[model samples]
Target: MHSLARRALHTCNVPRDLTQVTFCDSAGEHPDRVGLDGNAAEAVWRSVEALYRTGVHPGIQLSLRYRGEQVLHRSIGHARGNGPHDPASLPRIPMTTDTPICFFSASKAVTALLMHMLSEQGLVNLMDPVSYYCPEFARNGKRTITVHQILSHRGGIPAIPRETPIDVLWDRDEIWRLLCAAKPVEVDGAKVAYHAITGGFVLQRVLEKVTGDTIESYLDRYLRRPMGMKWFTYGIAP
Candidate 1:
């Protein structure tokens, strides 16, 4: 096997054959989706390589899958930049198969899935009042708001006030209190705008309270363990 192919398989827990990568479901049942996109994958990788030609080298990695199989894997750039050749004072990054970078956003869909399961098992009613479980939630005009409002981005409370201490982020109740105390800008469900950052925490608390389970515990017991995927994070990992 090519060294890059070998490296990608080892790091990504995928099979060696980039041409036809498929794996049996861990649930011991049917196959999920599988395969690779050749042309589009080439276009994406070439675009990244083009950026380096412009002297704007950035750490870049691309992974593309077709159906469910990974067909393209490319990592390029440096943790630090390459000197003057860098167009700045950074060291040039030589792309390798396994360098880490952080990207954010998309916990919303995962949180939504959690809600789906909750609704599925009848643990909570999405359309029911938030105050039904969190009495303080009713303090402001939020008394009638539903978990569905929060999940769908229909919750009036969008951006948290500026400079709210970062330390308070991981505390669900603290964030919940802020949300409850704040006034809604919209009548629940009139229009939905992206919550950006604050939506995740706000929805998280409602989910936690209604189900009587911490988000961590809920994710562990229901989603992660069930699907066998571990892609959750609230803060710095130990």
Candidate 2:
């Protein structure tokens, strides 16, 4: 019965051949340019291959640099289809080195950096209460929450209210309204609860209030363009 079940499972959900899904930009790899021997580079790539075999990530991209030169730039797996539960008929989209992926929580680092930049410019004081910039944030007993507290995950507004719809994340105005209206879990900055999504919107409001500009425009002008980043915006353009 065990052997029969194994056969049935394999027949129903056949694993994809890794070679069939792997894609690489041959021109982008230049180990010799960085003085890295081919064997060493291949060894590193083999580790990435091992990770891909684990089936945790649907897609993976690697751009390793050595001595300021690109030694390996490669990608593996589908960007869209080929999930373990996906139907075989679903069309697969190859995850290329150029494919754009969501940075998610990684963007918090950029947001925090921008806030520090604002401080350096004398536009904001990290220790000051957020209400000092955007008075609307003072609603719901959050008047004392400082910008530094928010950046450090002590803003007291950890998760959004349980009743808030998931769709609110995409609606800037609605999300801001909800965050402003929601009450805090605590306000002394004595706890270390993660803000998750709330701190970002709060920080954004403070930023926009002080700069008189949208965060997206600010990021593009100050960081993305200056650094020649191809895709580092808040959202992908449709």
Backbone Cα, N, C clashes tallied per candidate: 8, 0
The local distance difference test score of model 2 is 0.84
The per-model lDDT (C-alpha) reads: 0.62, 0.84
Number of the top candidate by lDDT?
2
Candidate whose TM-score is highest: 2
TM-score of 1: 0.60
TM-score of each: 0.60, 0.75
- Candidate 2 per-residue lDDT, tens place, 80-141, comes to 87566666588988889888889989899999999999999999999999989888888999
Superposed on all Cα atoms, the candidates' RMSDs to the truth, in angstroms, are: 9.5, 4.3
Please, what's the RMSD in Å of model 1? 9.5
lDDT accuracy of residue 235 in candidate 1:
38
